[model samples]
Every structure is written in C-alpha cells, then in structure tokens.
Target: MDTAVEEPQPDEFICPICLELLYKPLVLPCGHAGCFWCIHNAMQGLSFSTCPICRQKYNVCPSVCSPFYYYLKTMYPKTFAQREADIKKEEKDMREQSSPSPTMPEGFDPSSPASLFKCEGCHKFAENPGVPACGHLLCDECCVLEKCVVCSLKITYIPNVCASLRDHIHDNYAGLCSSGPLSSSGGGEVRDKFFKVEGPGVKIQMIGDTTARVEIDEENFLHFHLGCDMCGMFPLRGAVYQCLDCPEKVGYDLCSTCYELQKDVNTGKFNQTHTKDHKMVKRPFNVTKHHLILANNP
Candidate 1:
C-alpha cells in the first residue's frame, strides 16, 4: 500500500502574479484572480488598473473571494501553509531592507494618474492618509473600521497620518491634495467629484459597499446562463471566452477578462485539462455556440 501523501501539483492552483499557490485570492469582475498582495501591488490607484495578462481595465481592488480562498486552503493545505510561511519571511526581509523614507509613497507620482492617495472606502483623495498593513491608503475618516475594507486584512497598526507623505504632496504637487476631510454627507459629493475628474468608464469599488452587498444581498444576486470555469461564477455573465482547442465536449470557457489573465492557467473547474496551447474565442452574450455545445452534450 502506498502511504506517501502526494503533494498538490504546482500547475493546478498557482497565482499568475506570484507563481505560487494562491493565497487570499481575489477574483476580479473580469473573472481573473490573483493573490491579494499581488493585486495590491499591481493596482493603479487614482486611475483604472489593468489586468496583468489581458490588460482589461478596472478600478478599485476587491476583497478576497471567500469561496475560492477556502477551496484552495482545503485542497492543498501543505502547499498553502508553506506559501504563507515563505511570504512572511519575504515581507520581513523587505521591511528590513527599506527604512522609512519621505521621498513619496512607492506607487504615488504627481506626473501619473496615481498622483493622489485616494481612500479605498470612499474613493476620495485622502488629505490625511491612513496607511494600513495591506497598504491600501484610506482617509482618516474611513480608517475608523478595524478591518481593511479592500483586502479584509486585520488592521494590526493604528492608521495614523503619514505626515511625510502629506508634506510631500502639498509641497511638490500644489492643489492636488485636498485641504481637509470631506463632510460626513460628502460620500455622494466625493463620488460626483471623482466622476467629473476621472471621466466616464472609470469605476471605483467602495470596499464597504461590496462587503454590505455580499452580506445583505448575495442570495438575491442575478444568475446568468453559463458559468465561468475559472472564477466559478455560476451562470456566467457578460462576454464569454470560449476555448477552441480543448477536446472536452462539456467545453472549456472563461470570462473574457479571465481568459486574458489566465492564458497560462490551462486547467478547468470541471476537470477539463486546458493548456496554454489551447486557442480561445470571445463570444458576446447573445452568441449561442456555448449553448449549442451544452445542448448537444446533454
């Protein structure tokens, strides 16, 4: 009898950004997924961020997808635990090398769209910013919560005003920094102002709203016609990215955004062994090719 426990295959559950087991995976609206920190690092604050693979545009990072996060944890406990340990060491090493500097926030630049430090909760320019462990900048007013609304990470350190950052913004980028916090009723005003400034097609997900919607209205969420194989969004909605190369009759399909992000990820939710060699085609919502495949298979 073989008693050795087989290790989980690296190719099955790896994050494209980190090239390791997915940890605290956050599924994007495009149906692609990435590790929380990886997404955080990739996000272009104050502007629309693009999918690392497909370059699909998005703004506001989301919290961890609870279902997928737990599934990976259960399926590959050993590898997940090892990845956690490795990340901790890497973070510690990174912190040790970089002492606090007043040059400017790493991702912030006056010349770029990410010039301002926007609150993750309200999407308002944080005059006095609160830096959390996850590094999602928030206004002091939005920092009242104990957990980060963006990643749901526990706030280990009190969110204090980064004076150095504040001074840098004021001195270098005159008028970019707001003079003070918005009024209590300024949520709408802030949103309107952001829209006017950022222009149309720009979206900023208020982390708090996402939390409330998930808890209060998840059961009432709309279901689409087909499910995305990558994000597990049942009754997949929007543009469907269908694989043209997989031999499985059940078919391999991803959300268009996910298709672009997961080009390297060739596996499927239903056991379709898709590979990088597989070609995919994007189908609009009205297209019946996917339905035809399902109908014929059944």
Candidate 2:
C-alpha cells in the first residue's frame, strides 16, 4: 500500500502572488483570486489598482471569499494545513523583526468611548462610519478615496454606512454622534493630500540612483509579456527568473528580488506543478526564450 502524500491538482487553488495554496483568499471585482495579504500588499493605494493576472483596474480591496476559503480548506486539508503553518511562521518572523513596543498608559480603559470604535483615517471616534470591502470602518465622507488610507487597500466601491455601528454609536455615544461630522477635512482634501490618482496601466518610477533595482526604465526592461509570481510585477522588467521544472502552460516565473527572497514550496500560479525542489534559470525577456521554455515544458 502506497502512503506517500500527493500534490494538489487544482490550479485555481494556487495563489498568483506567492504561488502557494490560497490562504485567506480574496476574490477581486475582476473575478480573479489571490491571497488577502497578497492582494493588499500588491495595491499601491496612491492611484487606481489593477489585478495581478488580468490587469483589470479596480480601486477597492475586497474581503476574503468565504466559500473559496472553506472549500479549499475542506477539499485539500493537508495542503492547506501545510500552507497555513508556513505562512504563520513567516508572519511570526516578520512580526518579531519589526514589532513595535506597546505604549499604553498606566490606567488605560479599553471600554471607554475614546477607546471604542475609531476611524482608521482621521483617528476620530467613528460616529457615523461606513464599512468598506476590506471591512475597516471609516467615518462618513472620509470613506471617499481610490484606496483605503488605513489598510492601503484599494476602494473598489463606495463604502456603505454600517447601520449596526451607526445604531450602536447612536445608542451609546449619542453626544459624539450628534455633535458634528467626525472629520475636520473635506473628502476632496483627503483625496488630494493622501490619495492622488496616477495613470492606470503599468506604473514605472525611480527608486534611487541604482539602475538594477525595483524601479527600472524601458531601456533596462527585458521580459515583454511576463509577470513575477511572487511580487506580482507585470511586464517583468530587469532580470527575470524562469522555473525550469514547472510543468504548466503558463510557466512559473519570478523577478530577481522574489527569486532571491522567496524560495519556499510554491505551486505555480497557473496550476503549474512547481515545487521547492524544482530548478530555475535566469533569462532575459525575449519571445524566443519564452516560446522555447513552453515548448520544452510541454
């Protein structure tokens, strides 16, 4: 009797960003799916955001797709469990490295009005707050933006006023609710100050003097029609790393940064059978090279 574990066959369950099993996956308005953190981190929040795979423009970051989350969990328990453990360890390491020190006063009251619900944008008590797709509560009128100021998640649709929270504020903190609007700044001012809209398509900018960094120009660009699986960089510029062992039509590829940093067990984004043991080759962005890779793999 063979008892060896088998790899998951369904490619849709794989996250495009991390190339791993979709953990806490959020389905975008464009109907594509990616891990919640992946989607959140991918968003620049300064302008319109686009889907990693399809390049569909959107402004809001949506909540976790409950059905996809549970279904993946139930259908592929072992794979999902392994992914969870790996992600947890990674998060723990990150937190330990950058965790901030607590600065609570000696006699802090968690139940106080000031300590209760507060808008993430203005830091005022969210009297008449609206709930966005990311589920973070912001005060009315403060919710207007291309991206959420709190979580930096793109705001796809207008946040609806949370009736329950509105009622709660009305019942408990009626004085604050009836006082005036929570934000001192206008929606236009907030939009201007924080959320400036840049062009929608592929964004290019300069990082520093370094020509071989994240910010590169068309002169330094290589891969014409490829994307980095880890960082979700479309039209992957600079050094592109192609997975030699991935057996998918949409070959597993990565940018130079992701290749160096992320070397974990990731199933390829487009259902490719990529594992940690697989070998990768660095290549320039050329149609011939891309076609050759697909031909060899197929």
Candidate 3:
C-alpha cells in the first residue's frame, strides 16, 4: 500500500479566507494577514469590512506590512513560493465561486475596480496613491490632505495610490512579517484585552484629549462596565476615575463614591494600597450633584 505524506504549514503563514499561504500578503488591522486580492475581493460592496475569521471591524485597509513579507520571501523562500502558488489557485477558485451578484451595478468588473482607488478629496481615480495607516485613500494631488477620512487622526502619506486603490500596483508589496506567534493559543484574546479603540471619548482637562480620552455616549457613559477598584461597586453611569499608575495603567477603574471620598482620612476611599500617590483622572459628566460627607467618630 502506498501512503502519501501530508505537508505541514506554518500556521501564521496561512490565510483563513483562501485556506492557503498568503500571496502579496496584507496585514489586517485585526492582525490577520491574507492575500491582498483575496481580502479586497472579500470586502467588496460591504458597508463595513471586518476580519473574515474574528469579525473585528477593519476600519483601515492594510498594505503588505514590510517585515512580514520579507520573512516569507527571504527567510522561507520555498514555503513562500508554495504559498504564492496557493494564492493563484485560490484566486482562480474565488472567481469560479463568485456568482454574479443580483444587485451588482451594470457593467461592474470586480478585478479592474478592486485595483483602482479613487481619492475622496479630489474625487478622481489614481494608480499610485498614498495609503494612510488608517486605511483611507489619497490621490497625488490630495495626498497632502494628511488626515484619515475615517478616523480623523493625522495620516502618513506615500504620495502615489489611494488607500484602497494601492492594491492595483504590485510593485508596492514587500516586507518582513513578524516572527511566529509567541503562543499558538491566546493570541486573539490577548489582543482583544488591549487593542486601541477609535471613538469620541471624554477629554481630561490636564492631560488633554490626546493622552487620555474616554469614549462615551452623548449622555457621557461608557459602552462597557468599569468597576470601581476602591469601593468595589460598578460605576454604571457615574464618573469613572483613571489611575495613572503602573498596573492600573491597564484600566483599574474607580467608582464615583470612591472618587468623592478619595481624599478622606478616615474612610480611606482613595489613596489606599496600590492607589497611594496615584494621580487620578476623572471622566467628564453632566450630573448636577452634591457630595454628602459623614463625620468621623474619634
């Protein structure tokens, strides 16, 4: 009996969408990398594009981040070549798999357009437009408008293709991918715990909005529950406190009651244990309120 051997692939080198090695790899905001063509095609016509595997919103369109690409090409040439072949096959399969969308506009060519990016500022198509880190596009004339249309953060421009349109130019792809994942498991969980979010957050007076901003609704409340480290109560809608300390820098939240009595000598509501000498930043609020103080019995 003749038995065939299975080829083992580096898990990090695999793209979930094509189920193959990444070709012209693009490192997504969700940290998942995939074939540039596969990703752009997968995201077409969607209101919002997200990671195909994790469903994390991909607000920014990614280029082939240099480090990872370099590793795949230079360090692991054989594997990289195999992955490239897989990408071509996957692409062909995708084209075959795609049924003409009933709602597709008349005369829409997915391949020709996916590579073409239009500048929002000038409203023109571009071949080599600059792509900002935030995934917005900019044409040559408009690349100078260095602000992300989506995020409003300052943009770094490359002065050629628009953000989404850069996929059209094959020459731009090159890089060294990061080393293998530290642990096969917990990669996603660890990222979720600390990934930076983009939103309209509350601005602190001293630190300014740049260093510290809390994302809240127009009513000034967080989307998630932040429990008070001091009183151990969930500060549901109250003004939460931020500890500018070592471990607490990672989000050791404080409730309003503890905040009000933080300076108390007897109650020890604030500066106790790890919180001692920690400077606290308070989230802004609109509640018209008063603090009722209790006298200490000596």
Scanning candidate 2 in windows of ten residues, the lowest lDDT window is: 185-194
- Computed on alpha carbons, the lDDT of every model, listed in order, comes to 0.51, 0.55, 0.43
Q: Pick the candidate with the highest lDDT.
A: 2
Q: Per-residue lDDT of 1-298 in model 2, one digit per residue for the tens?
A: 9998775554545777999887876555444567766886787533357768656565554554333354456557788888878877976886521111112322324445343356657767677666555445577666777666754655545544443335435555667766643333211111222223332222233467554222223334435456655444445556778988776556888767668757365443333567888888988434344333333343
lDDT of 1 by residue, 167-280 (tens): 434444446665642232110111111111122111223467443111212222222344456544334444667888887666777655466555356355435767887787
Off by over 4 Å in 1: 95-197, 200-298
Please state the error at residue 195 of candidate 1 in Å: 11
Q: Rank candidates, lDDT, best first.
A: 2, 1, 3
Candidate 2 local lDDT, residue 113: 32
Clash count in backbone of candidate 1: 1
Per-prediction TM-score: 0.33, 0.34, 0.32
Candidate 2 Cα misplacement greater than 4 A, ranges = 1-8, 96-298
Better of 1 and 3 by lDDT: 1
